[model samples]
Target: MGRQVLTWIGAQAAASGRRYVRLATARDDRPLRAYYERAGYRHVGDPPHAKWPTSLYERAIESG
Candidate 1:
């Protein structure tokens, strides 16, 4: 059910011509990062002056 919802959201993003889905997670959050990785997100970098050690990630919206 979770995967289905994510897939649907990805489809919507793609249909809207968005090239990437961006998100942020705490750098120390290994489990959360793993979850995003499992969903195909790649860690890009960290945001500037973040209050906590937050990491940025993005997933490409493959054009159909």
Candidate 2:
């Protein structure tokens, strides 16, 4: 299931000019971080957004 989703995302990113994809989860989503990391997302940093902390990660698609 994860592989299928990743493949779909890759295809979507290729078709669309998506520079990066992000998911903002609650603090209690600590367990889910491991799953995302294994999918090539790195923990870039955490920045406070709105009233919650946002975990930022990115994948490069093209040169800036």
Name the top lDDT candidate: 1
Cand. 2 Cα-lDDT: 0.67
Per-residue lDDT tens digits for candidate 2, residues 1-64, read: 9868866776678679787766555545786777778777777777765477566665554433
Off by over 4 Å in 1: none
TM-score of each: 0.82, 0.63
Model 2: per-residue Cα lDDT at residue 15: 70
Clashing pairs in 2: none
lDDT of 2 at 14: 61
Alpha carbon lDDT at 54, candidate 1: 98
How far out, in Å, is residue 47 in model 2?
2.0
User: What C-alpha lDDT do the candidate models reach, one value each?
Assistant: 0.90, 0.67
Across 1-64, the per-residue lDDT of candidate 1 in tens digits comes to 8678778878989989999988899999999899889999999998789999999998999886
In candidate 1, list every pair of residues with a backbone clash: none
Q: In candidate 2, which residue ranges exceed 4 Å CA deviation?
A: 61-64
- Model 1 lDDT at residue 44: 97
Worst 10 residues of 2 by lDDT: 55-64
